[model samples]
Target chain A: MTFTGLVGRVFMLPLRLIINTCVRLRIHPNTLTFIGVLINIAAAWALALGKFVTAGLIMVVANIFDFIDGKVAVELGEVSQFGGFWDSVIDRFSDLSLFIGLIYLYSQLGRTDYVMITALAMMFAIMTSYTRARAESIIKKCKVGFMERPERIVLFMIGAFTNRMAAVMWVILVLSVFTVADRIILTYRELRDARQVAA
Target chain B: MKRAASLPARVLWNAFYWTYERATWQYDLMVIAILAFVWLTPPDWLNDPMASGCGPLGWVLAQLR
Candidate 1:
């Protein structure tokens, strides 16, 4: 087995247990998804309120829900186009809420500089996801980027736990911009290749 | 959109399909770095007095006082 696969399985053990319990409860995946977003909003609220440790802990719980929702859906045989769409849309709102919290916190601290930096980070983060989604609509898959949602979430948790949010913002801004560019380039290259093949 | 596959097949496919693929050793190293940073970083570094102390509501209260 691959090294990452082994690590992934070890990490997923607890999550699998949770997924099983949720499955036995016969809970709807959409409900789980809804609950996840609500928890994320609470995490954002905590972040805005300067409860950094509490926010980090809450975000861990929130991401557990995010990670398992699709698994629960598949287990329940409840995967649908709408389920996918709902998950994607709710994710955007969740991402926006976290950035809003950071922006609000910075503004409250009278740090206009960090507020602008956080806003730019947020914009690039959204663009990272948007570019992939838009490119995927044309291409079969547009998973060319290195800084995907999982990486971003991990970085957020790290920032919150370490109180290194300023550093985290800069990292997110740079990596997300690169990710956005990577996706656009991938789409362009793929389209050009397709046209050549057709010609 | 189409439910052509059986439940088991669908589950198996979804398992691989949805999970993010971290193909390289660098990805694993990155994960390790994150875990290390979270656990090992000193509290003093990047410590923001304003952020860690008074929240928005507290700031507002201070303003009124």
Candidate 2:
């Protein structure tokens, strides 16, 4: 198996039991997704208070909810287009809340520069998702990016655990910008090629 | 997957396998850049010096000392 697949499997191993329990409990997948967002919001609150370890731990639970929701949906045969869309929408909120916490913390510290940097990172990160979602509407699939949501979440956990969030922001900012641009170019190429094929 | 493989050999093989599986120069470059920033960048540059003296790893080192 590939490295990422191996890492993903390892990460999911512990979550598998939780997922099975949720499924057996017959919990609604959307309820799980909603609960995940609430937990993530609490994590953002911890982050804003500069409690890195607490925030990190809370995020781990939030992500477990995130993982379980999808698996439960699949296992319970509750999968639907709206479920996917709702999950994605909640993800955007979850993603932005973390950055907002950082921004608030930096703003309180009067570190306008870090606030700006954090904001830019947030913008680019969302744009990476936006570009793929927009591109996939045109192309069959547009996964031509390296800085996807999973990578961002992993980086967030690493930064929180190590207290190296500044460096993590830089990495996210650079890679996310590249990913957005990559998607744009790939979409353009695919659309142009499709046009040529039609002609 | 070979159980008889030496540790260093397994590490080297995994490195090769990872690069091959990544399938994009940009992915490799991004990984390298992150590693470089982690290794080479000054803590002061990021402006979070509170963690510099006793971040998680530093605290562990302090405990050891």
Candidate 3:
């Protein structure tokens, strides 16, 4: 295994321990998920204000909590349909609020182009998630894509920490759109094959 | 005498299987795509937004200066 993999495993150890503790305490996973979303919103707002390093730190910490919620849920045997649904819904809102905060900051800075691009990226990102949901609903497989939520969060952190907000927006725009397109194509192929067989 | 299923019936079964398999493929593909995107993208691309030097990065650095 790669050194980074080893480091990641080591870092996750403490988180796992915390999750176990939460489980033993019988804490509700949804509560932790909500807390995670709140932290993400705060971190995003900090980034929007150009507090890059601070925002990056907060984002990283928030993501750790995000990861822990699921483990906590599984350990506590408190996983429920509502728990997953709540997480998904809050995640969407958290993502939007974060970008909206950036929009506010960029508007204040008079960078309209960056604002537009960021908005586009945000739209595409949301669509990417929606496409998967819709495909699944239709009983078709459509999960082929290059960007996912974890990567998106990491990219945001990198942008905030390194102070390269434009680059982050660009990456999000390209990858998120690509992911959406990938899903559409996959869905089309599936439906087409099904049709051919029916004929 | 045992008779083979009709062509229409065979086609229907194949179609059903195809739909099932494709849906399963899509679900798995989404997971793979996400992983690849995150792991493959360059850090430089990730850093571009702040590179403009006129946005938040600039504002923060200006305060320090």
Predicted candidate 3 versus true structure: per-residue lDDT over A1-199, tens digit per residue: 4444455679779878888788788878888888888988898789678788888898887787778877788777778898889888988887887798788888888878878998999999999899999988875556566577876887788667766566667768977887787778778878888889999
Model 2 clashing residue pairs (backbone)? none
Query: TM-score for model 2?
Result: 0.82
Tell how far residue A16 is off in model 1, in angstroms: 0.8
- Any runs in candidate 1 off by more than 4 Å, and if so which? A1-6, B1-20, B30-65
- Pitting candidate 1 against candidate 3, the one with the higher lDDT is 1
Note the clash tally of each candidate.
0, 0, 15
Per-residue lDDT of candidate 1, residues A1-199 (tens digit): 6677786789899999999999999899999888989999999999898787888999999999888989999999999999999999988888889999988998898988888888999999999889988998999988865678888887888789877777677667866777787778779989999999999
Which of candidates 1 and 3 reaches a greater DockQ? Answer: 3
lDDT of 3 by residue, B20-59 (tens): 2222544345435543444344434344444433444445
DockQ of every model listed? 0.09, 0.13, 0.10
Model 2, A1-199: lDDT tens per residue? Answer: 5445556679778888898889889999999999999999998898888888899999999988887898899999999999999999999999999999988888887888878888999999999889889888889988765677877887888778877778888888877887787788778989999999999
lDDT score, candidate 3, position A140: 50
Task: Point out the higher-scoring one by DockQ: 2 or 3.
Answer: 2
True contacts reproduced, candidate 1: 0.13
What does candidate 3 score on TM?
Answer: 0.74
